[model samples]
Target: METSGYTTQIRDGLFDPSPRDSIFRVKAAVADELAALDDTARIRSTDFFNHTFAPDFVLTWPDKAERHVFLRMSYDLNALVEDVALIDSHDPFIFGLTPNEGTEKDSRIDGAVEESGAMFAEPDALERLIDRKKTDSTANMLSNAIAQGGRGTFIGNEAVEFASVVSRGFEAASDVKAAGTAEAISEIEERLGGPQAWRMNRVLQAVWEGSEGPLMLFPGKADLSGRLNIESLRYLVTYMRTDDPEFWKRVGRGLKMADLEHLDFAASRPNIERLIKANLDILSARAMVLVDDPLGVGEIDRESKFSWDIRERRLTFEAPGFFAFIGATKKDLESVRKTTANPVAVSTFVDRAEKAELAEVTLHSGSEVFILKHEDGAIDTHRLVGVSGQFDGPSEVTQAIATSSSGRVTVDLTAMSGTGQTRSKIRLADLLVTATPLLRDLPYEDTEALNHYLAYEVDHGGVTLDVPDDEESLVDDGVAGGAEPDDEDE
Candidate 1:
């Protein structure tokens, strides 16, 4: 039988049927072994020897003060063993005082430093996903602006203007930097597609149409508050129109008097309800960012040095002087994807469109006159249609694209903030790269003192052998440090 991974089952064979008797016997055996050692030898070996008679048996004397030690071992799913010794002492844990009096100091700097460094050293996978989403959204927003020919769309000779008045109020209160300037936004929009640009403008106009004052969507008012409020409107419209009980329950806590009236009106008409949901989905799918307060606030900010505080739901900016912070739960972010049927295909097309940088082009179905840049490696086959129109179509764009490219499509739907946004893992090898600057900044006297202290600690902390009873006689006989080596030649 394959019994290697089962530590408990394997160790059980060593014991009698009764657990109490087994424990007693084990303790007796350990005590018996210790009794054989002399006081001097015991003291010397305590700090020197780590007695591992078996995988389950671990002993550490470390010194006369810390003789009582317990072994802890566990196996992971991969059958890898982790072992450690927890020492108990009558003397306080550190500084040679009673446990209650001594303020135990963790002198092992290496361990604490390594643990603190891991968070910043290794970039989290989730952070990478968020970064990609940010880039995609920025690109999409810029592309949308570019497609509009540096102007808003018109309906029956009336130009559809962006709700600049409402947007200005948000802009002034918050230091939120739009993903791009009007020119860049317009340029990218043109490059991606004109119809998409128009659609985007229309969506923006719809949200800002009736809003005269600050719309408080969330509980707090800080940077990116207004923008996130606008984004949440999409979900609000859907949940209210569809009468989603759970969504309503959650929103009820945050809803205002004006919001209640608006929802009541939206829920009254079926066509308006459908229109709102469709438009919201379109906005969410095109480019949206979901953050878990990457710029930590309150209790989290104090605890994490203002890094991400997912537990408290406080947003934090990765870099200093960052202007905006949007926070949301993963569930809220994923809901956008869940609502869309052909996200991958649309995402892939957007990526390609951004890459090509065309001013305007037709979709696959050859129905909608959209703006898309044509590059050397552009997607030529499998046309898309009705992308500009509501219910234009949902097709297997992902499957079609997959056939052309062997590489997998990666689309990140969320963006986060933190140091991980910029750098990857920092290994031990990076110590020189990181520490040199700090070392240079320190005064020569401090550096010398630091070096001397480290050397002294290293020398004193090292284990040493006890002097032999016949030290002089052994030295005279050419035996040193306890044992003499046998001459292989002889």
Candidate 2:
């Protein structure tokens, strides 16, 4: 009944039996109706006046990631009554127009942001699942550290296996999933049992152990998957383990890499793989930040700027610093009832853990995190660019967090000789984040016109923020790296 959400059966009722003659019949009917009209005002009221007569189909670049986007178009789903009026009265082709349109977000993955954000939900209850600290296991610790560090190397080199990079990124991000830094990288080995954190670390160990390469890999796909951008995740894994033959075996077979000759890698004879190394080296240092607001909303804003050349093969990313403000709300801590195989007297416990844990935490706004802060001329709304973090609060609080007057517009930037840093600056109604000029050791790699800021907030007991600045400009080499990032998730 449908090819792109349209029905062939509906086509027969609107027009004559001969589909080929419909256009001509509609045209003749239109001519007769126009001729019968005495005034222009009547003509303007005709059915044709409100419709788009003709439109153009946009040509696409096949190799670009964003090429053919699909959007569901519901406006034309209804079958209209046959009009005795003007043009296209018998045009069966009118029914053939698809009600769906191709979308334009090329960087998007197979799933939408909301769908991908579901992975961060709680895996199991506390008593049901146990935590396994990983850092105590020297062998895994070494392997994990190597893979994590090699992620940096792979970021400098694009050929690394995609799975390897993503696994490591996920492990690093998941470390912050708990209430505290009880399981820092140094403590992972001891924490490695069967907890969500351990399971993620176990996956990272697999990527490292997957054929003498970086440990990075995860499931192909899952519905409602959070922070689960397939290709982008794959790209990170591939970045660290390019030498592994199996890496190419899994991904290239499915994506038709050889068939895509129009891509820069396919066309260039001089330096096909030049950008590979350049991008890897830069992004390797760039921190992947995790943000949690009250609304099940998280964002990744970076202080690190990336640089890449389309003509020449070059790229870079670095993390000068990182910051985040995470909060919880009553709505996010609701109890969940579950039926399990090992039912123990239908037990009941107050769910201390935030039930809405990290659900919807993802790179929906573009990358792994979104930058929600922007510039406005108000005294409190100062700009704090190059920060990374998400709102770790419950969904209810996300609505409470104030944003700029203009609707939130998230953008990715490219830079040259620019600093690669990640930081998150959370500003509330009374709380303000002032982007102070560079002071102390700044993260900027170059002396570009970079904007910076500091966050002010209140914790369990007292207000938090350094003393207000006395001067506008800085006294040091303009590097302000000393400001401690926001504290542990509560």
Candidate 3:
């Protein structure tokens, strides 16, 4: 029975859409017949069986052109099965529906079809050809589907193309000879709008088990040399593994956008910390330079162990020889001026110093003793004496005194011994400067004297010393011996 373009035949029940009249039953019959053929014969003619005839016959049996092409393919497949030698001589059938062919026979197809036929004729080549054909077909199907779904915009078009290339590359990742995957990935990255678009596409984001997944979405080192914004960086940090050294190496090649001062540090802190831990030098340096404070100067704890100099608008963290200064300007408290240090560096330094057993100070005022490093590297403990008001002296001298009072003091006893015994009285500023390294290691105190001094300095620009002039009187008399004076100032 002939219906429309399809020719219904009853030969061994094959190609017969019978009582059921289902195209699926006809395909099953054809599949069974193909299965019964010799493995070599079937494998050699897989392209013919799988593509040229079967799909068209099953998919478009009602179309006259497809039906006519299917009949021709069916005749060829049967003839080749019977003769076997015919498979080596006959040219493979080409699907005319392919847009690239455009009704003209593709010259490129002839050599490939001839080569496939020759390979099929060889017993040893059948298995390799079958494997390769399967891989190629799978990759082609993925590419074709991506190509067909264009949104008509330039970015949309490139995005579709990017997805196609990525899909094909991943599909062939398992093939040992597929060294072109990396090259293909590079080619697609050049055409892509940006890395952010990678995760936006469901096809690109689909993770392949035991594969790199969207890792190839990252721009190559040469491409990443340009600046990336916080959002782009956030995308990379979110998807890329911290443990992957290669990911960091690539990230290190890129420059971050200059205006990250406005970045949401709180939301991005975890990612930034992860990058810092991964040894991302660029981000590390940037973190040390940009200051982000959600809380402005008013909320700053002036008397905290970590010194906040209201006059200088600086918060200092001191550990032995290391000091990190971070603060905001009056103009913008959330972000420090370009000249000021980054607040992020404050926490980073704290974490590092604590991990290294270098320094840890409480922010609140407490009875923690001051740590004094002597000239011999031996640490001496001293009970911190409560002193009131800022030291009155030169601006530079008072600044030095404020620094010393803020944290632990390192004194060089060897340097102070010469001038100490002879002098009954010394300038308070001079004594603080000469005896101590001027280190800010202690928490800030809200003492009436210090507050008054800070207030006077802020208003009048300087304060005068009110303490006793006697040098011996400066030391806490409660200690067994007088204060071991240090000469070498830090």
Candidate 4:
């Protein structure tokens, strides 16, 4: 007969007929042979076998200081003899002991017994393992969803329902089948949509299903506090309104609110406005813009100049004598020129402006106010009187002024104490350093820095001041009092 491995036979009448005596003699003989292989080995009857009443012996010993290994051998006689041979030689029958070589039956019994022992050792081990596996599978699903652009792919509760199905399918399967089921579930989950995807999908549905687009569902202020992939939302709107793959890619990379300021939303204006209102809290000034004009009226007027305060989210149109302490770039200045009527003035401002972090811009009917914070914490306020239409470039400042306490130095270029004062020509460059000594060390020529600084200031506050034709004052009254006026007219 075929056996797993080596086998040995013993004469049937070698021991007493009594089962207990016979078993003892058989074990004693086996122990002698086992000792030759490992002196420390011990033999025990596991009472597990392939056939009824047949027992299996386990030989276990320490292989290393703290590690143990075992071998199993089964004792059987009927399995070894043919049917005809067994009938003829029933009296002089031979018994055989065959070593078990990790067969399917032996493995299953070992696994069951080991698991039972483990349950006694740690009651929550299996549960913890299963939980960990589930968590890992979920993480993999999310990763795949993100990598495959699975955003907005699912409907409400669909992802959860699919996950439940996968779980149930796994549970109904056998151990071997369960492994295959789990793998298939992982692949399927990767393709299925997730929570964020479902949210996007819902938004898309709302936009397409209603006449007012997303505004029909979220009219006043939509709250999208935790959503990070705003690009997808932008893509949806942009795709519906226009087909610009390059712009879409840029949106995908992530566009600032300022970037979208120039983009024409067309039919998707309501959707874009909804998105903007929903994320106002998280939108920085550099990434956002506030327009005073009506939506879808006409092309943006490139000649109208405006100043933006980042912290206050204020925008001032055609404001004169406003200072932008925030950073700006040539590119940003060019973008501003396109929206303003006075490109020459913007170009001029671009040539002279410097980047600063702690300045405020306010427009007064007859005066311009500038608040300057010095290195020594001293605040100097400078007011420019009767400087109308003098500095009309796109001015953007950082948000530092809005969030800062009153301790901040503010330069209000509003109408000064003297309304009908004689105006003297003063160079804009001289006014900046004279108002704030800190500006002397800063690079005023870097337009890039100015663009960055403008982003912050415009978000805070942008004040518009009307210049009265009567107050043509050009003299630096406050910090620039001692400086002599240049011969050239400003």
Candidate 5:
């Protein structure tokens, strides 16, 4: 009922008695209708059906002439009264009473909760909706009641409004268009709160499943760009891990993203390993290990084979490659950070024979290692190693190779090098042995071509990389210049 020119807000889809005796009187008036049933039409629970988008019932009659009676009451007077005959013998009428039923001429409140987005599909789908909805709510009171077979309603218009909003969201999600980025789905999440947000997540997961193209979230991050091929799957996985506890365990077990198999296994190794740790289904583990870019951990004793004990929450793989090992190290570090524990126990081993000069260097949390390997040929360039915990800033460690008789390698951590130089040399050797593949792509070319370009740009600070507006191309290939190009500017 209207209070002080406004409707009092109901809490948890249940009637909240106002301090004024007026609303309490309204509740008492509705309760009086239960006396007509004589206990034959039992109310298992007093459901605020309108709060959940369902019609309200006033009373139910048993052996009497009128089997069901609906009271539409306003604060001042009773609205239209309905006395309907029970057509079905199995049907038992439930009561739902709203405060403003009689005052307004809206007879369209005949719709039920089954007509709303809460029950967008049939019974099975409806049950799923309730379960998911329950999980989304911070208070489990409503969900607990719902799970305990408490189903029915007391209000109408409010229920209709709630249903309409949810229905629109469901319809929007059902469109099944793949949002190109994670931020788009985040915006969707902001728009669809609570139960609808979960549905939206499901819709995104479905869209990702059906799509054939790669979806990139956080596309600007060069490493995370082409690597994250499985559209909104990451968002869903993250959501389940951080927000909804039940869905991740129940529904996430059946989750599969075939596109994960197509990700650049070597480049996305870290991400794939993290995903495995977070989700850890057989499909994910197999995708991580059996993909085209294999971990390259050669066969060992049968005991050394990869194993995942889901029940125990333990994962083990013996003699994994540098990529897999680094990935595991990162995951272990994450777990440690979460619980504020020391992560020194997670270790990687290298055979001493292979790592003669530098062996048994543990790359754990708070550790840094940089390597500079010199190229033997005309390139005269070096490779900078990118270790997980290393390279916090510009690397101080640099190595120079002299192409003389012995082909000696000297480590330089600035000209005044003693202890720093020694440490650099050892770390460089360890890095070379452990992370050769990552280092290969990042060759540091300290050639004259680059030097000359840098010098010219420094001398004329206004120089921009883009070609001048008058010029046809950045480089003067044959097509842009005359056949016999003069040295002097034309």
Candidate 6:
């Protein structure tokens, strides 16, 4: 399984393959286990056992109510394996795998599709581990695999050695006992808070120049500050294990990859968008930022009310926003840039938007000639399903709103109409909007992305986006100084 001598030189490429075929072979074994789930063809004994308990504690089903209920996950690994194996056969130099110079302005693909020999990923190890959770009880099995990876000889031992180095660092960390383990994780996170810290922590090259195997732990970005996370070490060791007790919990626990110390920041319960994103076979890890946040259109008539529909391929969505369709895939995100690039249609949003300037009402629900005021405020008297509209008492005619593209107000004229006469009145209310910056490409701006820009003051041509005053995170930047803080010496 030694890969040190066969693959690309570590100083050279970030995306390189392992010299050992065993790694993929082991992964292929894992794939077989997951594929077993779909093997309904396999006959099993009628007898079943019951031992289900959830740390989150929710009744998932009638019989299995007390146990932690897992959502199903499935993918065409047959295709994935083909793609992975394909990456091994060719070098970018020979096959044009590296990113072209022109692609610099464009976003990087979540998975490298077209390459110029620059970057290559061999079935990401972390992704392979997470993918196991889709099958029944594979989380526990994968945990066992990861746990064994470290202690056992062969490839597993290599995994162990890496974990050992991380553990040694964690224990030796000065912040260990003083702040408590969890808090220490927080402190280490604070230390690695900036995007650059993460980039620095990455393994510079995927394949090393010479090694018995890929150099497991080259201190390219080891934290000497003695505040690194214990789980960082533990994750390295047990990430591949499904039977590791915490495997399912880790995957099932939280959907969002919050900031380092965000373990303390509680999630505001899961919503529709989150549920789909977490449970889908292919999660769109791509984060999107909002150029202009959309709002809801007031409830109106059938002809005037807004409506939206979801596309077949799309699965992820950001709510109470613009667009008609509701879901998307990774490829769809790609076409946005590849396409004309003007007003890129991301996925199939319902295009159901409410423009304050375009507010209008065609159907009057109840011959109630109430003043339908515009911009003053609006309400949903009948309650829209996929449409948004409004009616005021003192106003006459007003503009219109695009609820689907903008907000989540719904209307079902089919349900609430009388002889071609509209009959509902909804008063308008000021938007109760919560402004959260939309995250998109370049979201994970690790040091690699901002090469040579570490702690460079923004005033002196440092890498800084013109973030809105209200939207930018002081917590993220670690420079809480307000309004206009000097970027010079503290």
Model number with the top TM-score = 3
Q: Per-residue error at 201 for model 4, in Å?
A: 9.0
> Which parts of model 2 have CA positions greater than 4 angstroms off?
1-5, 8-10, 13-15, 18-432, 436-490
In model 2, state the lDDT of residue 470.
17
Rank ordering of all candidates by lDDT, starting from the highest: 4, 3, 5, 1, 6, 2
Off by over 4 Å in 5: 1-110, 114-195, 198-304, 307-374, 377-490
Residue range with the least summed lDDT across 10 consecutive positions in model 2: 343-352
Off by over 4 Å in 4: 1-231, 235-255, 258-264, 286-330, 335-490
**lDDT tens digits by residue: candidate 5, 1-490:** 3321112222111354444454444444433323221222332223332222233333332212122222222222121112212112112233333343354433333333222211111122123333344334311212221221222332423323333343343233334333333443453343333343443445344433223223342111112222233433433332221333222222232333333433343333333434433333222211011111134443342232232111112232222321221111112212211111121211111111122222112222334443333233321121222343254443322212222111121211121110111111121112222232111121123122212211211112221211112232212311110222112222
Rank the candidate models, highest TM-score first.
Answer: 3, 5, 4, 6, 2, 1
Candidate 3: where are CA atoms >4 Å away? 1-182, 189-250, 253-270, 280-378, 382-490
Q: Tens digits of per-residue lDDT for model 2 on 22-89?
A: 43343333333222211111111222212433211111222221111111112222221111012221
Residue 102's lDDT within candidate 6 is 39
> Candidate 4 — what's its lDDT?
0.28
Measured against the true structure, the TM-scores of the candidates, in listed sequence, are 0.15, 0.16, 0.26, 0.22, 0.22, 0.22
- How many steric clashes between backbone atoms does each model show? 36, 89, 16, 68, 9, 85
TM-score of candidate 6 relative to the true fold: 0.22
Candidate 6 local Cα displacement, residue 326, angstroms: 2.3
- The true-structure Cα RMSD of candidate 6 reads 23.6
**Poorly placed runs, candidate 1 (over 4 Å):** 1-289, 292-407, 410-490
- Give the runs in model 6 whose Cα sits over 4 Å from its true position: 1-158, 164-312, 316-361, 364-373, 380-490
* Residue 467 alpha-carbon offset, candidate 5, angstroms: 29
